[model samples]
Target: MVGVSVLEDNLKDESLILGLLDRHPIGVAAVFKRKIVFASKGLARLFGWRREEMIGRSTRIFFSDRASWEAFGERLYRLLEERDDVVLEWPLQKKDGSPIICEIITRRLRPLGDDWIVLSTIRDITAEKRSLRRLKARSSSLRLELSGALEALRREKDFLRRIIDLVPAGIGVWGPKGPVLKNELLRGLLGENIPREIPHLVGRLIRGAGRVFRFEEEIQGRHLLFTLSPIDDQNILLVVEDLTSCVKMREGLETLAQAKASHLLSQERLALMGRLLAGLTHEINTPLTFMKTNIQIFGAYVEGLRRLLEGAELAGEKRKTIDKIISEIRDITKSLEMGAERIAEIITSVKNLGRKESFNEEIDLGQALHEALILTHNKIKHHLRVFINGEPYNRQKGVPLLGVYTTGRRSLLVQMMVILINNAAEAAQRRRVKGATLEINVEDIYPRVVLTFRDNCGGVPEEELSRIFESFYSTKEEGTGLGLYILKEIVNSLEGTLEVECPKEPEGLLFRIVLSGGGGGVERIFNKTFYKGVQDGHQGIGTG
Candidate 1:
C-alpha cells in the first residue's frame, strides 16, 4: 500500500485485450509456465479449435505430426532457458494440418509473492505466408502468359514483315484519322521525314478529306499511287505505292502504239480505200459520160438543122420552109436515140465493203510482218536498228498457216499485227539506250507462227515486268498505257497468246507471240460483243 503498483492493476481489461486481438489479423497464442495456456481468436481459428480447447494444451500438441514442429519446440525451450523474456519466430500447425509460421514474445510474470509465470504472446504469420504464395503463383502465371503472347506476336509479325519487305512495292497502313502511319516494312520507303508522333500524323491525314480516293499523288517529292480506303467508314487507310517507274513505261508503250495505229489508218485510207473510193465516186462518172455523148450528138444535129434552115429560107417563103423544118426534126430524133446507154457499171463496185463473204486466206505472217515494218518505218528509221533471223528461207518452210472465216472480217488481223508491232516499238523506245535496236525472229512451228521480238534498249525492271499488261499504268508523262494491253487483246482475240521474256543472259526484253493461223476467226467484228472483254483497261503496259 506504499504506492499504487502498475503491475497489480489490469487497466487493459479482458474486453479491451480481446478487442485489440480481434482487430489484428495475425494469430496469437500465449504460453504460461513453459506450457501452451492461451491463444488469440485468430490462432484458435487457424488451429481449427475453440480458444478453450487450446488454453491448457502444451505447445507441442499444436503440431499435427508432432515431430514436424520439433525444431521450433527446441527453439522455444532454448529461449525459455536463456531468460524469462524471449522474442522468437517458429513454424506450427493450422486446423488443416498445414504449417503456420509465427513469431512470439515471452515475458515472466511475478505477482503476489514468489509465484513466477511465463506469458508468451504469439503472432500467426500464416495469412502473409499464403498471400506470398498466391502472389508468387500469380506472378509466375502472368509472366508465362505475357511471354507467350509476346513470342507469338513476334513470330507472326516477323513472318508478315518478311513477306512485305520482299514485295517490291512499298506497302503502308494509315489509321482512320490519317497522318499516323503504321507500316512494319514500308518505313524504309518513307526515309528521313518520319513523324515522331503517330497521333499527330493521323490527325493530319483525315484533316480535310471526307471520301476515300485512289489516285496518283506526289507527296514529299515521291510519286505514289495513293489508294485510299476508309476502313469501318471512319479510318482512312491509305496505300502509297511508288509509280515513278510505271509511268515511264506507259509513255514508251504509247509511242509505239501510236505508230502502229497510224500504219493501220494509213493503209485503210490509202491503197485499200482506192478501189472503194473509185466506186463511191462513180455516181459522177456514169452521169458525166452520158452527158458528154449527148452533147456531141446535139452539136452534129445543130449543124444539119442550120443547113436545112438556110435551104428553106433560100426557097423563099411559106409551104417549102415548113416541110424543111419537119425534115430537120427527123435528123434530131436520130441524134437523141444514140445517147441512152445503161448506168449499170457504176452501181456494181459501190457495194463492195458490204460483201457478206468471209476471208479464208493462207495468211502469210511474214507478209503481214513486212507490211507492218513498212508502215512503222518512220518510228524506227532514224533511232532504231532492226535485225531479223529464222524467217522462212525456202518454199518448204511455209507450213500453210491458213485461216478461214465464214464472216468477212479480215481487217482485224491487220489491226492485231499493228498492235503487236507497235507495242514492240514502244518497248524499244522506252528502253532509250544508246544504239538500241529491235530484233525480230520468225519461225514456223507447224500449227503456229512463232514470232519473237527483242530489243537491245534494255529489259523492263523485274518489279514492273508482271504488270506490264495492266491498264493505265505508266512511267511516262504523256502515256495512256494501253499499247501492250491492246496488243494482248488483239492477239488473244485471234486465238493467239503473247508472252514476254526477260533474258538474264542478254539483258533485254524478248517478247514471243504465238499465232494460230487458222481462220481470221469470229473475232474481227467491231460490234458490242467484240469490244466487251475482261476488266482489263487499256492503260500502262508495254514493259513486258
Candidate 2:
C-alpha cells in the first residue's frame, strides 16, 4: 500500500508541471529520435498544424531539407550536454512551406527510456528579424546622404574663398588680435610695412566703437579711402578704395571749365568793340559826303569868278587886290579838299576794324528777318502793333518765304534786323503811340529785294533826323546813339544801301533796306501779318 501511494504522488507532480508548461506563451515540444512525441497548441499554431497532426509527426517535416534538420538536432544535443540549456536561432519552414526564423531554447531530458529526448521552447522571431533588417537598410541610406552633404559643403567653402581672392576691392577680416583673414587685394594694400595704428583700429572696430569709420589716408604715395564695418561681436571687415585718379580728374575738369569761361568772355568783348567801331565809321561817312560835294561846287565857282575878273579890265591896285583875294580863295579850297580826303581814309579804316572777312552765301532775307523777329519776340510782343507784308515764312507752319533771297552773311542780316526792331520798339514806347503800327515790307524787285520798316512813332525832329546817323547822338534816355549808325554800316558792308524818308505823310517814319538777290529759283509760299494782342498763343511772327 505504501509503495502504491508513493508512485501515485510522483505521477500527480509530473502531471501538474506538464499542465503549467502547456499554458506558457511560447511553443513547447518534446522530441525523441527526431520525431515529435509531444507538441503544445502554440507550436502547432506556429506551424499551421493541429496539435494531433504535429504530435506524432517527424521533426524533419518542419525543415526544408533533411541535412539541415539533422545538423540542427546534432548541434542542439551537443550544446545541451555542455550547458544547462542550448539556444539556437534557425531557418525553418511552416506547414504551408513558407520560410521563417525561429529561436529555440532546448534542454536534454532523461526519462524512464533508453532513447534521449529534448524539451524545447520555441518563439517565432521573424517579425523582429524583419524590423532589424529595415533598420540596417535605413542606416546605409543615412550614411550616403551624409557623405553627399559633406562634399557639397566643401565645394561651397572653396567657391567662397576663390571669390574673396579675386575681388578688386581690398578686403580683410580684423579681430581683437588684429587681421584674421586677408584677401590678395588686402595683402597688396598693406605691403611689407603695416601701420602700427592698425591693431588699435581693429580693436576699436571689434568693440562696435562707431557707426562706420571711413577716412582717406596716403599709403605708398597712393591715396586710399579706408572703411571699417562691423561684421560680428569679435570681427570687422576693412575695405580700401583708391581715389587718386578721381581727384586728379575732377581738378582737371575744373581748370578746363575756367579756361573755357575766360575764352567766351574775350570773344564777347571783341564783338562789342566791333559793334562800336562800325557805328563810328557810319557817323564819319555822312559828313565826308557833304564836304566833298560842297568843295567841288565852290572850286568851280572860284574859277568862274577869276575868268570874269580878268576880262573886266580894272586898274593896277584894284586888280592886284582882286588877284590876291582870288589866290586866298583857291588856297582855302585846296585846304578843304585835302582835309576831306584825309577824313575819308580814316572812315574806311574804322569800317573794317574788327571785321572778319567771309565769303557771301545766298540766304532768304525774309527768312532771316523772321528768325530775328522770333528771337526778339519778348521785346516787341507786348508793346507795339506790328504788320508784315510779303510772303512770310512761319517755321511752325512749315511755310517758307518767296524770292527774297540775298547773297550776304545771314548772321549779319539777322543782327541788322534785331537792331532795327529794337529801335522801333524803343521809339514806339517813347512816343507812347496808341494803336502803334510798325509795318515791314519785303518785295523781290528782279535782281534786288527791298525791305521797308515803317513806324507810326512820332517822327524825329528835322535837326535830329540829319544827325540820326551820327554816333553818340541819341534821342532815347538809354540809347548809345549807335543804332542808326550801325544800321548804315551793315548796309554798306553788304554792298547795299539804307534810306530814310520822313515827310510825316503816309507813315510817321520810313526806312528802306535794299539787298542784292541771288539764289537758285523763287518759291512764293505763304503771306503772314502780325498784330499786337490779336493772335495770342500764336507762333507765327510778322509785321506790315
Candidate 3:
C-alpha cells in the first residue's frame, strides 16, 4: 500500500509540473538524444504544431535546414557539457515552413544512461530583433547627419573668419562684459589694451543704448571715422574706417580737375583763334583773286605796248621813254603777281584750320570714291588699275557698284578719297611696278562702315611709315606732306579711325578706314532714291 501511494504521488507531481509548463508564456520542451521526449502546450503553439505532434519529433524539424540543425546541436552539446545552461538566438521554422527568429535557453536536466535530457525555453524574437535593427540604422543615420552638420558649421565658421580678416575696415564686436571679437585691422588700430584705452566708449557700448554714434578723430596722425551701432540688447558693433587717403585723393582730384578745366578752356580759345585766322584768310582770298586777275591783264597790256614799240620807227628818246614805261609796268605787274601767289599758297597751307561745313550730310562713301576717281583720273589712269568693291573701275558708269554710306560732309569725304587715290597713284608711279592694282573695298559691318584701300605699290619704309601722317613729313620731292596729315584731321573730325599696314606677301600698303555707318533708315531711303534715279536714267548720290 505504501509503494502504490508513492507511485501515485510521483505521477501527480509530474502531471502538475507539465500543467504549469503548458500554462507558461514561453515555450518549453524536453529533448533526449536530439529528439523531443516531452513538449508543453506552449512549445507546440510556438512551433504552430499540436503537442502530440511535437513529442517524439527530431530537433532538426524545428530548425530551418540540416546545416543549422547540426550547427545548433554541436553548440548545444558543447555548451551543455561545459555549463549549466546555453542561451542562443537562431532562425527556426514553424509547422507552415515560415521563418521565425527565436531566443532559446536550454538546460541539461539530467543524464539518462548514455544520453542527456535537456529542457529548453523558446521565445519568438523576430519583431524585437527587427525593431532593434531599425533603431541601430536610425542611430547610425542620425550620427552621420550630425557629423555632416558639424563639419558644415565648422567650414562656415572658417569662411566667416576669412571674410572678416579680409575686410579693409577695422571691425570690433563688444559684449555686455567686454570685447567679444576684433578683426586684425581692429587689433592693429586699437592695440591689445583696447579696454583700458577706450573705457568710456566701451562703457557706453555695454550699456546697449539703442542709439547709433558716429565720430571722426585723428589718432596717431591717421584720420579715422568711427561708427558705433547696437547689434542687439547684449552686443554692439564698431566699424572704423581710415579716411586720410580719401581726403588726400579728393584734394588731388579737385586740383587735377581744375587743371584739366583750365587746359580745356585754353584749347577752346586756341580753336577759336584758329577759326578766326581761317576766316581772315578766306576774306583775304576774295580780294587776292581780283588782284591777281587785274595784274595779269595789266601785264598783258604792257607786253603788247612793248611789242608795238619794237616794230615802230621812232626817235631814240621816245623809244627809250616807251621802253622805260613798259619795263616799269612789267616789273610792277610781276611783283604783284608773285605776292598774290604767295598769299594763295599760305591760304592753302592753313585750310584745315577752317571749321568744317556740311558735316551733317550723310555721304555715300562709294559715290565719294567715284567722284574722287573721276577728279584724279588724269593722274592715275595710265598706271593704276583701280577696282571699286571688286569691280573694275569704269569712269563712264559714273556710279560705283557698291553703296556704303556714312555720316560726314560729302566734299570732305570726296577730298579725303581724292588724297588717298592720288597718294596711291603717286606711290605706284614711284615704284614703277607693272600691273599696279588698287583694290578699294567697302564693307557694311552694321553700325560701322569699313573701307579698305589695298595697293600693290611698293610700301613705304617701316621707319617712315610711323611719321607718314605728320605735318610737312613727305616722302616725295614735290609733296607738301599736308595731304595725309589733313586726311587724318578730317578723319578725326568725322569721328573715324584710320589704320595703315604694309603687307609682305603682296608687298603693298593697306589703309583701313572705319566710320559709323548710316543706319537702316538711311539705307532704305537711299535705296528708294537710287531706284527712282535708275528709272529716271540718272546716276548720282541721293539727296537728303
Candidate 4:
C-alpha cells in the first residue's frame, strides 16, 4: 500500500512539471531518432497542430522542404556530437504551410539505447528580422543623402573660391568674430604690413547705420581704394583696389584719343574723296554714252562702205586690197566699242561704292553676289574658279533660288561683296596659285543670315588677321589698306558682325558675316550641281 501511494505522488509531480511547461511562451519538443517523442502545448500551437498529433510525428513535419530538414538534421547531429547545446535560426512552416523565421535552441537530453533524446525550444523572429532589415536599408539611404548634400556644399565652396580668385581687386569677407575668408590677392595686398586699425574700422563700419562705406588710403606709397559693404547683420565684405596704375592708364588713353582724332581726320578725307569720285563717275558717264553711240555709227558706216565695194567690179589685187582695208576698219570699230563698254562698267562700279541711300530696302544676298561677280569678272577671269554654295558659278544662271534676303541696301551689299571678291583675287594673284578657288556660301539660320567667303589663296598669318580691319593696315605692298576696313565699317553700319578665320583644310582665309533682319523665301535653296567653266568658255565661272 505504501509503494502504491509513492507511485501516485511521483505521477502527480510529473504531471505538474508537464503542465507548467505546456503554459510556457516558447515552443518545446523532445525528439528521439529524428521523431518527436513528446511535445508541449506551446509546440503544437506554434505549428498549428494539436499536442497529441505532434507527439510521435517526424520532426520533418516542422520543415518546409526535405533539403532544409536534411540540412538541419546533419548540422544538429554534428553539433550535438561536439557539444551538449546548439542554437540556430532556421526557416519553419505552420500547419497551413505559411513560412516563418525561427530561432531554435537544442540541448542533448539523454541517451536511450542506441539513439539520443533532444529537447528543442523555438521562437518566431520573422517580424523582428524584418524590422532590422528595414532599419538597415533606411540607414543606408540616409547616408547616401548626407553624402550628396556634403558633395554639393563642397562644389559650391569651390565655385565661390574660383569666382573670388578671378576678381582683379583684393577681396575679404568678415564675420562677427573675425575675418572668415580672404582671397589670394587680399592676402598679398595685406601681407605683414596690414594696418592694425583696419579690423577695428571694419567692426565700426559693421555697427554703423550706413549700408556701405568708402575711403582712400596711401600705405607704403601705394594708393588704395577701400570699400566696405555689409552683406547682413553678422557679415561684411571688403574690396581694395590699387589706383596707381589707373592714373597712368588715363594718361595713356588721352594720348590714344589724340591719335584716334588723327585717324578720324583721315577717314573724313577718304569720305570726301569717295564723294568726289562719285561725281567724277557721273560726269564721265555722259561723255562715255556719247562715245559708245559714235562707235556704233562708225561700225555702220564701215559696213556700208564694204557693201559698196562688193557691188563694184575691180581687178583681183585691187579687190583684195580694198577687202583688207574694210576688214581692218571693222576690227578697229569693234575694239573701240569694247573699250567704251568696259569704261561704262567701271563707272557703274564706282557709283555703287558705299552708297548710303535706300538703306531700308529688302536686299537679296544672292542677287548682290551675282552683281559683285560681274564687277569682278575681269579681275578673276584668268586664274580663279568661284563656287557659290559648293556649286560652280554660271553667269547665265545668276544664282537662282538662293532665297536668302536681309534688310539692307542692295548697292551697299553689292559693294561689300565686290570688295571681298577683289581682295581674294588680289591675294590669289599675289600668291600666283594655279587653279585658285573661292567658295561663297549664304545660309539662312532663322532671323539671321550668314554669308561666308572662303578663298584658297594661302591665308595670311594668324597674327595679321586681327590687324587686317585696322585703319592703314594691309597685307600687300600696293593694297590701299582701306578695303577691309571699309568692309568692316559697312557691316557694322548694317548692324551685322564679321569674323575672320583661317581654314585648316584647303588652307585659306574664311570671312563670316552674320546679319540680322533676315527672312527665308523658300524651305531650301542652292540644290543643284554646277560644272566649272562658263558657257561661252571665256571665264571659268558658273552660278546656280
Candidate 5:
C-alpha cells in the first residue's frame, strides 16, 4: 500500500509539470504521433483559438497547406534525429483561417502511454521575416548597380587615356606619389634619360597650382616650353610645346610693321607743316589788307597836297625847291603803298597752303567762293581769268550763286577752294595760252549744293587720273600731293562727295563737289526760278 501511495505522488508531480507547460506565456505544445494532445494557452492565443479547441486537433490544422505540413514534418523528424531539438520557420494558421509566419522549435519528449511525444515551442516571426526579405532584395539590387557603375568607370578611364596619348602636345599627369599618367609626346620630350629632379619639379608645381608655372629647358638640342596646370588637389597636368619657328616669324612681321609705321609718320609730319603754313598766311593776310589800303589812301592825300602847293604863286627859286620836296614826298608814299600791297599778296598765297577749319557754320557758296578768289588773286590772276557763271542775285542763296547754300566748317571749304584755284592757275600757266579761263558754277540740286570747277587747262593723263586723290601723289614739280587728298577727306567729313571729270568734251578738267544742303530739299523751292536774268561771257575759270 505504501508503494502505491509513492507512485501516486510521482503521478501528481508529473501532472503538476504538464499543467505548468500548458499555462506558459510562449506557445508550448505536446504532440503525440503528429496529433496535439496538450497545447498551452499561449499556443492557442497565437493561433487565435481556445486551448480546449486545439487540444484534440491534429497538428496539421495549424499548417497553411498540406505540402507545407508534410515538408515541415519531414524536416523536423530528420533534424530531431540528429539533435534533441529542431527549429523551423513556417506559415501557421488559426481556427479563423488567418495565416502568420511562425518560428517553431520541436524537441523529442519521453514516450507517454505507448506514443512518442514531441514538444514544440512556437512564436510569431512574420514582421522580422518580411523585413529580412526586403533587406535581401535591396542588397541584391545594390550589388548589380555597383557592378555596372564599376565597368562604366573603367571604360571611361581607358578612353580618356587613349585620347590624351594621341595629342601632339607633351602631356603628363602627376599624382601625390609621382607621375601617374604620361603621353607619348612627353616620353619623347624626356627621351631615353629622365631628369633626376623631375619629381621635385612636379611637387613644386602641385603646391603652386593656384597660378600657372612655366619653365624653359633644352632637350635633345631643341628649345621646349613647358606649362604646368593643376587638375585637382592631388593631381596636376604638364604640357610642353616647341615655339622656335613661331618666334622667328613674329620677329619678321614686327620689323616690317615698324618700317611701314615710320614712313607713315614722315608723311603725316609733312602734311602738318603744310597746314601750319596755310594758317599763318591767312592770319597775316587779314591785317595786311588794311595796312595796304591805308597806305594807298595816304599816297593819294600826298598827291593832292602837292597839287595845292604847286598852284600857289611864289618866286621861281622857292617854287622849284618846294616842287622837288613835294615830288620826293609823293614818291616815298607810293613806294610805301607798293610794299604794303606786296606783303598782302605774299601772305594770301601762304594762307591758302596752311590753314584748317575747326567748326561748322552755315555759309553761302557764292560769297565763300568770291572771298576765296580774292584771297588767291595773286597766285592765279596773271594766268587765269575766272568768273561765276550764274544769275545776278538771290538774297537767300547769296548773289550770283542763286539758290545755293550749305553748312560746313567755313575755313576748310575756303582752303579747298584756294587749292583748286591754285591748281587751275598752274595748269593754265603750263599751257602758256593767253585768255585761259576757269568757270565756277554753284547749283542747288535737290537736297545738295553742287559746286563745279571747270578749267581750260590741258587734261591729266588717264592713268594718272585714278591716283590724283592719293596722298603723296603729285603731277607737278613742287607739288605737295596732299591738296586733292585733303580736299577729298574734308568733303567726306562734311558728308559730301567729290568727283572729277578729266579730258571732258571742251578740253578741260572738271571737279565737282556736292554737299548735303539745299534749302532742306528741292521740293521746298520747286517752283522758284533757279538762274533768273542770266548773262553771257561767263564761261571758263582757272587756278594759278
Candidate 6:
C-alpha cells in the first residue's frame, strides 16, 4: 500500500491532465516507469478498443514501434523537464481507417510530488484552417478590385478638372462629403485668401444628403451662381457658375427683343386698325356713299332752292318753297345718323378684338376658333380654308383628355393668325394660281393645343422654313422681317412653340404650333424640341 501510494503521488493529479484527457477526443496516456494504467473513452476510440481492453496497457499500440514511442516520449519528456508547454499538429488514425488532421497541446503541471508527466489537449482544425484560407483569398481579390476602381476615378477627376479649367465661366465642383470648395478658379477669380478660412464650409452646406439651397455670392464684383445636384447617397455635386456676363448678355438681348416685339405689336395693332377701318369704310360705303351723293344733290338743290327763294322774296312769294327746304334738311340729318351707327358697330368689333384677358383661362376651343376666324376676315377671306379637327364645342365627344381651354389673350392670337393668313395670302398671290390653297387646323391633344397651318403654295424652302420664324428672317420686301418672329414670340409668350416641317413627300409646308393646354405642359415648351421658333440667330431681339 505504501509503495502504491508513492506511485500514485508520482502520477499527475487526476484533477489536471485527467480532466483534459477526459474531454480530449484523441487518446492520452501517462507512462510511469513504463507501467500504463490510464485510458479514456476517446483514447479507447482512437485505438479501436474498449476501455477495458486499453486500461493498464502501454501506449505502444498508438505508435508503430518502440522508436516512434520513444520519439513521442522525448517530446513529452522535454515539456516536463523544462516546465513549459508543447504543441503538435499531425494526422491521427480514426477507427474507420481514415486520417483525421488535428492539433494537440501538452502542458506540464507540478501537481504531482517529484513527478514528470504532461497534460495534453487535442482539437480538430483541418476544416477551420481550410475555411480561413479561402476567406483570406477572397478578401485579397476584393481589395485589388477596389484599388483599380479608385485609380480610375482619380484619373477621371484630373481629366474633368482640366476640362473645367478651359471653360470661360467660373466652375467649382464638390464631390460627396469628401471635400467642398474644391475649385481652382476660386483663387483665379476670387483671389487666394478668400477660401483659406472657411474652405470646408461650402461642402458641408451641400453635402451628399440634405436639403439644398441656392445662394448668389458676388466675389470681386462678379456674380456667382450656386447649384447643388445629388449624384447618390455617396456623392453630391455643387456647381458654381459665374453668371455676370451671361446675365448681362441676356439682359441686353431681352431689352432688344422687348423693344422689337413692342414695335411689331404696335405695327400689328396699327395694321389691324387699318384693316378694321378699311372694312368699316367698305361696309358703310352703301349708306355713306348714298348719303354723300344725297348731300351733294341736297346742296345743289339747297343752292337752287336758295336762288329760287331769293327770287320768290324778290317776287314776294318766298313762303311757297320753305317747306321743301326744311324737308330736304331733315333727310340729310337722318342719313348721317344711320351711317354713324354702322361706324359705332365697326368700332365695337375692333374694341372686342383688342380686349385683354387671361391666357390661362379654360375656354371652349370652338369659340376661340370662331372668334379668330371672324377677326381674320380681312386676311383669310379670299385665301385660306380653316379646318378644325374636332367638332363644335357642345358636340365634343366628351370633355377631351386635352380640353380646349381658352386662356385667351386674344390680341396675341389675332396677331399670329394675321401673320399666318397674310403669309398664306402672299404665297397664293405669288403663285397666282386660283387653286393654291391654305389650310389652318386646330386640335386638342390633352395638355396641348395643336394648331397646324399648311399651305398649298407649296412648303417653305427647306432651309428657309427654319429661318422663317427668326427675327429679321423674312423673304418679304415688306418694312420689317419681324412679323413671323413676333408671331412666334407671342405664341411662345403663351407658353407655346411653333414647329415647321415640310414633309419630303407631302408637297406643302406644315406649321405646327403647340401651346400648353393650361396644365403641366408649360414646361414642355422650353425643351427646345417642343418649340421650333426663335433659334440661334437672334438679331439681338432676345424675347426668350
Q: Judge candidate 5 at residue 337 and give its lDDT.
A: 72
Runs in model 1 deviating more than 4 A are: 1-362, 390-410, 424-432, 518-544
* Comparing 5 and 6 on TM-score, the stronger one: 5
Global Cα lDDT for candidate 4: 0.73
What shift in Å separates residue 288 of candidate 4 from its native position after superposition?
1.3
User: For candidate 1, lDDT tens digit of each residue in 223-337?
Assistant: 6665444433234444556666767788788976986787678668766676666666576667767775766677677667667766654544665765566567656655444
| lDDT at 511, model 3 | 91
Show the lowest summed lDDT stretch of 10 residues, model 2.
524-533
Worst 10 residues of 6 by lDDT: 392-401
Rank candidates, TM-score, best first.
4, 5, 3, 6, 2, 1
Query: Between candidates 2 and 4, which one is better according to lDDT?
Result: 4
Per-residue lDDT tens digits of candidate 4, residues 47-129?
89997777667899999999999999999999999998787889999999999998888877567668777767776767668
* Model 4 TM-score, 2 decimals: 0.46
Model 6's C-alpha root-mean-square deviation from the true structure amounts to: 27.1
Score every model by TM-score.
Answer: 0.30, 0.31, 0.34, 0.46, 0.39, 0.33
| Candidate with best TM-score | 4
The weakest ten consecutive residues by lDDT in model 4 span 524-533
Candidate 5 residue-wise lDDT, 107-176, digit = tens: 6655556645676778676765679676445433433332233222232454334434433467666667
lDDT of 6: 0.55
lDDT of 2 by residue, 229-339 (tens): 666666666667667887788988897787568657866997888788787777778878998999999999999999998899899999999999999999999888877
lDDT (Cα, 0-100) at 28 in candidate 6:
57
Badly placed stretches (over 4 Å) of model 4 are 1-244, 354-356, 364-367, 370-405, 429-435, 442-449, 460-486, 516-544
How would you encode candidate 3's per-residue C-alpha lDDT over 1-544 as one tens digit per residue?
3222322433335544555556555687777788777777878888899977776778888988899999988887998889876779899999899999988888765566697777777867786676967644543343333222322223244323333443346866666677766777888876753433344565675585446667777767677777666655566667777778878889889977976686578679978998788788889989999998988888887888788879899999998888888888888887788667656655653463244757677766665675577567778889899987787776545545455678977767777788889888998888798999999888888889998889998888899989999865798898767789989998888899999999987888899989888457445645765676777876554211
Q: Rank the candidates by lDDT, best first.
A: 4, 3, 2, 5, 6, 1
Error of 5 at 368 (Å): 3.1
